[model samples]
Target chain A: MSTSSDEPAMGAKKVEGAGEPIPPGKPMTMEQHIVDKGAMMLQRLKPMKQISQHGCSFAIYSHDMTRQIETHHYCTRINQDFLQCAVYDSDGSHGRLIGVEYIVSDKTFEALPPDEQKLWHSHAYEIKSGLWVNPRVPEVVVKPELENLAKSYGKFWCTWQLDRGDRLPIGTPALMVSPQGVNMGVPSPELVRTRDLKYNILTEAIRDSRVEIAEPEWLNPMADYWKQHGKGFKIDVEPVDMKLRAPFP
Target chain B: MSQHPEVPGDPTATTTSLLEKATASIQRFGPISHIHQHLCAFHFYSHDMTRQVEAHHFCGHLNEEVRQCLIYNSPEPDARLIGIEYIVTETLFDMLPDEEKPMWHSHDYEVKGGYLFMPGIPGPVERQDMEKVAKTYGKTIHFWQVDRGDNLPLGIPQIMFALTREGQLYDELAQDVERRYKVSFAAEKEKRKDIEGPEMGRHPLANGAGKGLQTVLKEVDVKPPSGTTPRVFV
Candidate 1:
């Protein structure tokens, strides 16, 4: 039987210990290992089998465009119009799942309520700038995929802010925005240089090849919540009296 | 009249269609290729039992014991992206810290009660999958509140829970799912009778049983990136 290296091994260790260890404790306990092994043998993880695409990019905090982090996306295309990605801090075997991103076609995005549209950001700039790339796949195999993504929009949420030096996922989830352009002062020169160097590809060369991927004219104005509105949401935990809205029952 | 008031249709519709087709023919679309299962179920807000919404789970396995799912409000091509759920075995769930356990919900009830089903798959095949799912646990957070008639996902993400026993799920909701999918919950429940649940009862704290849990978002101050002067956006 051929085993795919990308597949998480049975009894895989829980992804932890990135950044400074808050409260700094010892490594995984013995009991944790045993339980993981037992679960590996007993459970059938049927949902992870479909991660078909891998892309690397940078994400800026929606509330603070100055704050940025490199993101490794393991995505599963739900259909021609939608794709969901599990965002990690790295592409290594031990990368932690820091957030999730949902990508939809312009057709799907445009249909959203105007207020709702602000939560999403367009991908055209990221694709055309060569800031978003699938490192493992050949350019020929990935271009068409980029072509489709060029006109798409994505809503990203990061549970763990490793860039902010958070020891673990704490506080409320933060919304993330895509890099718009170099002139925007996001996705710094160092970020692009490191990614290109690590992956052995030239961002400028890739950018030149993607000249045909035009920006969609009908792009929603409210999209890119932070940039367009000059303000963004900052999520936090608060106590509340919960009530049920209609149509739920 | 347009079905969506926000979208008046675009003039580039024809060129966009051609570009999509051309890309579809050659794109590898590697990331989404492993999605092989679509399980339909209902999720209620953890804070309120009376509020519930249909969840269409498109899942893929990452390993023998861990699975991740992307939940949609509907099964249609234009369905709204609502939430995400991560599933793990009882063994793994047992390893979680006491405070963390409450965030995860058990699948025993969702499976045995027949509230979960794979649309269009053969009963036997789906039953086998459900049997495996019965002993698992899931943690879900819904970003979009479609039930509230929100066109776009708004507000804070809320943690969600699964129905654990009889009388928790509304009858009308079950009927609506039954009518659309052409599957009887009663028949599915009967068929799943022989399926064994977790050897041990589900974690007591899971699903916020007998307790109210909700997420309320507050506005917080944003700190600049470490060791750098904050750049002000004009």
Candidate 2:
């Protein structure tokens, strides 16, 4: 994996002449120019080889899957049948090879840009809502498209809940995506209508399986990272290398 | 009115409101299970005969009547090490006895001594730490407080086998597979009534047709608890 640490890189490349430089106002070619610009941006992108367990977001659900679990990566869903998955290796701890996630929801992939999508497996995306792949199981379901995708692109459908609360929980090299799917938007569970400790009804309506964002604020308390700039912790890792991991076939 | 809350119904909605709803509904009927904020610290008393300390943690919290003195009074020093994982330490990782110690170097799960030991790593704190308590203070020990973070699993088997050394577990399980795959797994499906999955081996004896299902064999269910997916432990 290319380990580059750059974000919001230049969108165009200037062609230099002997004396004059042509402003990259418009690209000579669309695809090639875009690719070159992307490569340059990726190269110039400052890679942060550190991962924090904070500011991460998460979601969870259960569904079918039909793909062989490759090595180099692991099926972390407590219940594999439904693809309860999580991914949070971006903090540059082990680089990208460490925290590869699978079976992300359509919602998650939709948030990605085109380049980011290519960086992730093509077949990875979300599915229907309302279903839960409980945190304590080892089950899965395989759809036809998912099976083919897993075979062709090494991507399969998975259902999972991850805790991408923003920063690492511990605020160090240990970024954990519980895959329990933290709903940052989950309304604060009001005592609502409590007849007693035993009898009550909820007043506020919510969507999706609600989970209390323990961090309520997307901050991760654990990622109080030491200035590893000159530290041996993340001495030489590139950013993109910190994003993708090697999948064992 | 909206027919339903929406596709992604709030999971937090079920947190305690449903409990309230159920409890209220239950009160209308009659008194039920004592629903108090109870701490179920299940304890495994040190067996008198074995002279070994076996710590068995269940899906509960510590009770007031727990025997904390079982750390000593053993035939073999640290011979019987029973580990209990998933000790409801989700919110109390820092509350464990010795939370201030630092780990040398750890891979996968973080090392927390005084709590249940992970498979591969050395028992946190070494003998000196335990010796201090075992040799003095009447060997009083408290339950390990652990954090059930996202990566680690809190499953039954995973928790059950928490305290075991990783190398030891790997060796034993390999041997178990060898024996099963070599012998018991070879019996005919109709005859190998004991074997469950293809990975498992067949039972030893076919016996006869008249023996019935129970007499023939049984299946082993390695299924995890409901709701969650299986954890991929390193």
Candidate 3:
């Protein structure tokens, strides 16, 4: 996680002698020139302050509940409560935009009607379970963000189900939820390995960093309810290893 | 521990360099693919059964026919991501299957009432852009009902949209938004005079003209059962 001091300033190099004006009788096509000019204009007009960007990995489920897809999210925190994430099938620049996830705070979540509430899934499980992780960020930064996210809720819809060979966002939006409880599934081994290799850190290592952060009580609804009522609802269970499956055929 | 180690240099130079680095990173990730217009508006839940919850929308136009909006609770950063609204042209909407039609709501009421706006942009340009948006339909579903104060997202997702007609939006809600954003709906209405409102029909399944089919059917000029003389209209 190289911070500002370590990274070079953006476009600091001086433009060496302005390139010769395009030759009047150049062989280049007009369309090609227009595209080249458009790209430069877009770079100049880009909005900087309006967006806060971060990169992370998400373990998402298929629509038919058959496969667990490992997706990368290049998230832009538009504001404190709102994160409009551009989801990718892989972490590379070549990764296509497969879906988008909108995350809101508890305050915004309550404003929705009951039925609307159901469509969104809680992040408590994802955060508490240590499934959702930011491989790029430092542990210190990731810790607080996870603390905030643990208390937040998200409404995720995957547009591109790559397994089905769909290119564009076609068909109804599926309400994506994180796997719940101890026996819940894990992402594929290949996906995890690819992610781990990219970050140069193990998933277990990231999970270990969250040992001190207090797990929010709201994560387990039944347990929280019973605990509030002073009722003893205890279960003695063994912890199982998180095994990743092969990618869907 | 500081994320960035202090560099051994003049304090002013260090600050400038750091700011530039942060700026550069933001520039690299900020813009979406070919995003031209950024419009800010409001979306309200369509189901009359639920109390009105006003959701602020910051939308980016991907192209002529498609726009993806980031729905928020307020204009500020800490505002929650209540949901996402996908707006498409009439051609796209017409192509959708009949079953999917109910999920989408029209933008007529939102446009005409001046509740939906493209803030920061020029008045004429905003009006022109919104006119195109007004003709388009949106399919929106909000997952977080933050106004309810629930800790977690509870039940099923609810279909939502902007208030379509007069009196659908409360004066205080409009006033609050105007005050917070330092914008005037009355002035916006005046600016939007050039853009004519689209004529909407009583579509069988569509939430056209701001009211849903159930609400319309329930108040179909028929006499109320017993002594309940439609308190909604009054």
- Top DockQ prediction, candidate number: 1
Lowest lDDT block of 10, candidate 2 chain A = A226-235
**Candidate 2: tens digits of C-alpha lDDT, residues B1-234:** 111111121232232233323323322211001111111111211111111122321111122111111111111211111221221111122221221101001111101112221111122222222222111111111111122211211111110111111221223333443353242212222232221211111111100111111000111111223434333311
C-alpha lDDT (0 to 100) for residue B82 of candidate 2? 21
- The best candidate in terms of lDDT: 1
Better DockQ candidate (1, 3): 1
lDDT of 1 by residue, B1-234 (tens): 121112123333454445434444444433344344678899988777777889988664545566656787777654555787777778767765555566678899889988998776767657667877899888787877777765445556777888778887878888988999899989889988888778797777666543556664332233335545444442
Docking class of 2: incorrect
Range of the 10 consecutive residues with the lowest summed lDDT in candidate 1 chain A: A1-10
lDDT of candidate 3 vs native? 0.49
B1-234 in candidate 3: lDDT tens per residue? 111122111222343234333533543443343333334555554444234566655444434455555565554533554566777666656655554455567776577667776445545545655776677778675655665663333443445655555655657767877886578888777766666544454244455232342211010121223435333311
User: TM-score for every candidate vs. truth?
Assistant: 0.68, 0.17, 0.56
What TM-score does model 3 achieve against the real structure? 0.56
Model 1 earns a TM-score of 0.68
What is the per-residue lDDT of model 3 for residues A184-246, given as tens digits with 9 covering 90 to 100?
A: 234556766766777677876667767777766553332112112212111111112211121
- Candidate 2: lDDT of B151? 21
